[model samples]
Target: MGLECIRGASLAPLNTFGIDECAEQLCLVHSDAELREALALADQRGWPVQLLGGGSNLVLAGPVSGLTVVMRSRGRRVVRRNGDSALIEAEAGENWHRLVVWSLDLGLHGLENLSLIPGTVGAAPVQNIGAYGVELCDLFDSLQALDRRTGALCWLNREDCRFAYRDSLFKQQPGRYVILRVRLRLHTRPVPRLDYAPLAAAWQALGLKQPDSRVISRLVCDIRRSKLPDPARLGNAGSFFKNPLVSAEQAAAMLARWPGMPHYPQVDGSVKLAAGWLIEQAGWKGHSRERVGVHREQALVLVNLGGARGGDIMALARDIQQDIERRFGLQLEMEPQLLGN
Candidate 1:
């Protein structure tokens, strides 16, 4: 199907949070042309359009009142190769984890560290998704997107994207452009980044002298699986809050108080503190109120027990944010975007 539209579509299945909500209208587009058609249709009807990918990073706080377009375009290929480096492209709707595996199969490096991230390739650049010690921007080459304002497809380079720790131009200006495809620069050589303590320790335990991208990917997946709850079994987003960044002075003050709090110093003279550690230290780990609560194993994650509403989840998150501010005097920013209300 080129463009499929449904009225009063249930959004519970679209979002990983499993929030029970409905979209006034939902359109599934399988190609860039279809996507454009859907947008034109929405405009003709005077309805606001909302774009959704894997729905792994959104919260529906209320019923969606406009046209919700789901990106389902599909394609992937090796664009060109030169010596040890190669350029690869993937359609917006391809699964992120599958793309990582495909790159490894082709003996390409750089994407192995982001293995098992739950979302589409299109959504990856929006959040500049990262794991272990690698972010998408590290490997990103360029992307083709449709400028909604001008209706022209254009390419954006790395500098044009303006990626920063879990933030990007797409996120900064939501709904301005529709990403059609993404290109990443990869390598034929195995270049592993095992700076994260847990992953590095696991690698040492393996006792392997050779750097293997596939093995690194497996280890990252194992670590994530152990720490995060499966969205299939439990209704939840991967992480509820972004790790809070504070000034060097602020970090020094907190370290003096807690002494053992986990913090990573950045080159910009800022410190990235673990959001999970803060929640756990504040005694909210494994805490539940009604149908929403913090994950028992990972405090940064807020899970849906069952039959939970969007408002309930936000209320729980609000409580956690207020408590963290009261206890630590730092604000906790939510990672997922709110889709409604």
Candidate 2:
């Protein structure tokens, strides 16, 4: 099928932030061929191409001046099953939460801890999306991507993606490849991960002797629903900032002063400080000037109350960043991808 392009498309409905903006051109591609055709059309027209998945983790600054290709392809099935382990492949545009539920419905485990994460399957690896105690890298088998520059297809393994905490090679080298599909290895035997304090506490609170993936997934969904504001109700891109990593010595020094600061020591000799706690301590929680504000429940979430412009959100984020840096002497990095100028 030929690629269909829409000019002057409103971008507010495309992004989770609901920021008012427009795209010069927008194309929804349901297959790799359509994606390639759209890219080629952009090249022929001397316009840049921007790739968009679910738009859950994006901040549209203003009107985009190029062809924005929104991936809409969808498919998922078990590619291989060997004894207790099965390999499942899903197209880039498949909803992440739906995939998690589908895996559980098929008696496959390993994705329960990552339930309720927003975005498409393709965007998961880009951020190495993680929650509770499990990350996307844990079950990742391989992924098929189309190299935009060379027009070649490449299969990248976990190591090739260079998976890190909420980051990957796909993000390090932006606009290099368009992820087409992802393969994950799941097991029939339940392997529940409740090591995270919140999950463990919730499990203990439930007074259950043992829980399956479905139970754990339900608990996680409940926990997330309680803590996070629904984007449909109040516009938000989940966590707005990445947790700041600091040296052990720095963490110790800070802890000595605060005594109650939440921190996790990594195997790499670094400490991950909670950004939400820092933001809360800096007095930004439930703070707002006009339409942009920090969520009252989750200090990490910056919300668009109503009629908020991208600049207002950015300004509030900058103010929060400056306050946190000045108070804690640590820098917080934004998690969402900011598009346009």
Candidate 3:
């Protein structure tokens, strides 16, 4: 069955930011066949196609004069079980938070730390979503995607995905492959990560010597709530910039300037500076001009205080980039994808 394609589709409802935009041709594809058909139609029309998952990470300023295919497909099931771990497959359209809850119910423990993060499971791999000492790649098995150029479904292993900090192969080569479903290998037994600051603090407060994955999940949810604003009330993507990683020498130099600095040592021998702290120290915290502002609770978040345009957010982001560089000599990169280039 192909997509029952429509003309003049409004994208405002599809994206979480709710910026008023329209796709010349928009599709709500429930199946991969429908997705392929929609893409084929977009190809024939010479209009570039954008694959939208939950639209939580997108910023749409004005009318998108092209084809935007929103994945409405959804499902969760165990494809195969391997001893204590099983290969769990989720359709591209499955709500990410729901999937986490479902996994917890099934006694799967790996995805617990990623609870309450927005966007569909299909889009998680693109940015390698991580929180509280866990990343999506830790439990990754493989994923299936439709290659638009070849018009064939292809399977990519973890290595093929080439995931990095807030980056993946799909994001690197955008528009080439549309993710259909993701397969994860999670442990039946708990392998909890509690090394992160907030999670550890939450555990200490709770007075638990050895906590399970569920405890970490609850802690993460509470910490995130206290830090980041709810997107429904205030329009904003989670984090606006990637935590900049600098060399040891650079870190030492920065420490010389500001002795009180928060940093985490990366696996690749680099130091990940706290982007939120940098923004807060730069005096951008709670900074608002009209509708656009940096979140008061967490400076890493940029908010749309009603009627804020995407351009306004972009300007704020640029201002942060400039300020961070001028103050600390470290450049911050955007985590969200900017539309309407």
Candidate 4:
């Protein structure tokens, strides 16, 4: 049975940040039937529902109103298979990293490059999650979304989702649909992407000449472990700000001032500036305001050292925002889902 809808449900355990906020109502959905029932209950009670994933990419700013449906839908399976290409589908609640490892165990290649990212499989498409020169869109075959208004399940192909740099159509329409299951197109024939600067640096640093997909996966995980804080130890949303894209002329001007600026040329004739570099340039690295601070190792990540209220973290983010804008003449948008403004 699902957790009965309750008043003042503790939310500290629901978010990675471990903030002491309460949800006005709380419920869990383990299957499609229960999801529909929860939607009906919300409609009848005039209470909005907050759909929670693994709670890895969210900040609970204050006590949330209405019901929360923590997605607990479970299971992962090889939906279809061929000689080299196969369709791997996972329930929304399956741990993302676990699924990645599962695919690798099956000798699947496409997902190996994305190992160890935090959060649920369903949320992957919500932001078209990416890392280490690879992206969810690189393997995303399609997805099934449950429409909130009509309660109808519909399939969305790559074009329908409109995936783009850390964005997708579903992310645009928050609270409007539930991602039920995600399907990925993985390959048995291995091909690894190891051209990212950090990967190459790590390889050169370790005296490695060539690394396959699995080796690249392990290396990427190692690099991420060194930079990012474990959620169990510290409260943080990964990549608090998105890398800002600027015109080539603007990048040249900024390079003149900073000289050692790090960036990549986008296919659309734009330059992707590192948000971490910008934050560091603005002198916010290792900077703290009471409970919240910029992670010294990864300035792009805003961290909760201890008992940080989301508002405090947001204020620091705003400060970072102002500073980056002032310094670089470029604005960086936040990456986390902010609840209870």
Global lDDT scores for all candidate models: 0.93, 0.92, 0.85, 0.86
Query: Against the correct fold, how does model 3 do in TM-score?
Result: 0.96
CA shift at 57, candidate 2, in angstroms? 0.5
lDDT of 2 by residue, 1-341 (tens): 56789999998888888888999999999998898889889989999988898888988888889999998999999998999899999999999999999999999999999999988999999999999979999999999999887999999999999999999998899999999999999988898898898888988888877668999999999999999998899999999999999999999999999999999999999999999999999888999878999999999999999988888989999999999889999889999998876
Q: Taking the tens digit of each residue's C-alpha lDDT, what string does model 1 give over 216-315?
A: 9999999999999999999998889999999999999999999999999998999999999999999999999878888999999999999888899999
TM-score for each candidate, following the candidate numbering: 0.98, 0.98, 0.96, 0.95
Worst 10-residue lDDT window for candidate 3 reads 12-21
Q: lDDT order of candidates, best first? A: 1, 2, 4, 3
Cα RMSD for predicted model 4: 1.7
For candidate 4, write residues 155-195 as lDDT tens digits. 99999999999999988888877999999999878776776
Quality of model 2 by C-alpha lDDT: 0.92
lDDT of candidate model 1 versus the reference? 0.93
Tell me the lDDT of model 4 at 218: 88
Candidate 1 residue 253 C-alpha distance from true site, Å: 1.0
Candidate 3 deviation (Cα RMSD): 1.5
Worst lDDT 10-window in candidate 1 = 1-10
